[model samples]
Target: MAQKNYSGVNISVDEEGYMTDSSQWTKEIAKEMAKEEGLNLTEEHIKLLEFIREKVLSGSALTIRAIGKSGFTDIKGFYQLFPGAPLKKATKYAGVSKPSTCV
Candidate 1:
């Protein structure tokens, strides 16, 4: 595990930078992560992040197909918004642990 300080909160993450504790996540942390990915987060992006976080908290699997039906966007739009590996990157930005489905 690796530790990183974001907005005065220290959190532990995996080698891929995925947060280990979802409780430590904040919107600020998500924004910071997205920014680091060169993404300029908009309201839509925030909504999608919240959607994914909610699903994860509810013990649902995070998948590209599931995210597409989130009402935020379709699969193509998801890729447009999140670029490569939408599930992986979005989960990382949402401060959720890496999904088991991801390699």
Candidate 2:
């Protein structure tokens, strides 16, 4: 695990930089993480992150297809939002564990 300071709060993250404790997450932290990932969090991004966090905390498996069906955006739009590895990046910004579906 490693410590990353975001908005003056120290967060514990894994080697891959996924937050170790979701309870430590905040919108400010999410924005900082998004910025580090080269993304600027828009209202849409925050909504998606909130959805992702809620799903994971509720013990639902998160998938690209699930996100596509989420009504926030389609799969292509999801890709466009996070780019590269959408699920991975989204989970990170959501301050949750990396979904098992990823890699």
Candidate 3:
């Protein structure tokens, strides 16, 4: 696997898999990926997107349940956005998890 930068979006593949740029990844792409992961992009997806985008903008991380609690109602759909993401590190990447949350 190799790291790729698409339109300034950085990403890497861990397998013999091909890597794609997060920059090229649009809401539509996310929607499709969510569907493939068994998610229905209802308001939950929209909220997740908003949270992720916000974290990205603020240099932070976002969590499935936290974002869900923010306004979304579908935990299942939130998980679909990142089916393979580890539970703990999910917010670490977005830098959304604060010291308080960890404790």
Candidate 4:
């Protein structure tokens, strides 16, 4: 386990930087995470994050293809929203574990 300081709160994370406890997640933490990734959370980004979190909580698996088909955005749009490993980065900031499909 590792720790990341987000807005003065020390949150626990795994080796790959995914939050260990979803309860520790906050919008502030999410914002901080996005800042670390050189992004500013837009309304669309928040929508996608909420969508991903809801899907995960409902016991659905996530994939780029699935996300693309969900209508939130296409693959290119997703990559634009979250450059470089869109699924990995989006899920990380969403306070969820790295998707199984990610390396």
lDDT of each: 0.88, 0.94, 0.46, 0.88
lDDT tens string, model 2, 1-103?
7999999999999999999999999999999998987789999999999999999999999999999999999999999999999999999999999999644
What does each candidate score in C-alpha RMSD?
Answer: 1.6, 1.4, 6.6, 1.8
1 or 2: which has the higher TM-score?
Answer: 2
Lowest-lDDT window of 10 residues in candidate 3?
90-99
Model 2: runs farther than 4 Å from truth?
none
Q: Residues 1-103, candidate 1, lDDT per residue (tens digit)?
A: 7999887889999999999999898888888888887988888988999999999989987888998888889999999998888888989989898789655
lDDT per residue for candidate 3 within 71-96, as digits (tens), equals 54466654655466533323222223
lDDT of each residue in 1-103, candidate 4, tens digit only = 7888999999999988899898787788998999987899988998898889988877788888888987889989999999888999999999998888554
**Model number with the top TM-score:** 2
Each candidate structure's count of clashing pairs:
0, 0, 5, 0
Best by lDDT: 2
Estimate the lDDT of model 4: 0.88
Q: What lDDT does candidate 1 reach at residue 9?
A: 89
TM-score for all models, in order of appearance: 0.91, 0.95, 0.44, 0.89
Task: List the candidate 1 regions with Cα displacement exceeding 4 Å.
Answer: none
Which of the predicted structures, 3 or 4, would earn the higher lDDT when compared with the native? 4
Clashing pairs in 4: none
Kindly provide the TM-score of model 3 when superposed on the true structure, using C-alpha atoms: 0.44
**Error of model 1, residue 23, in angstroms:** 0.8
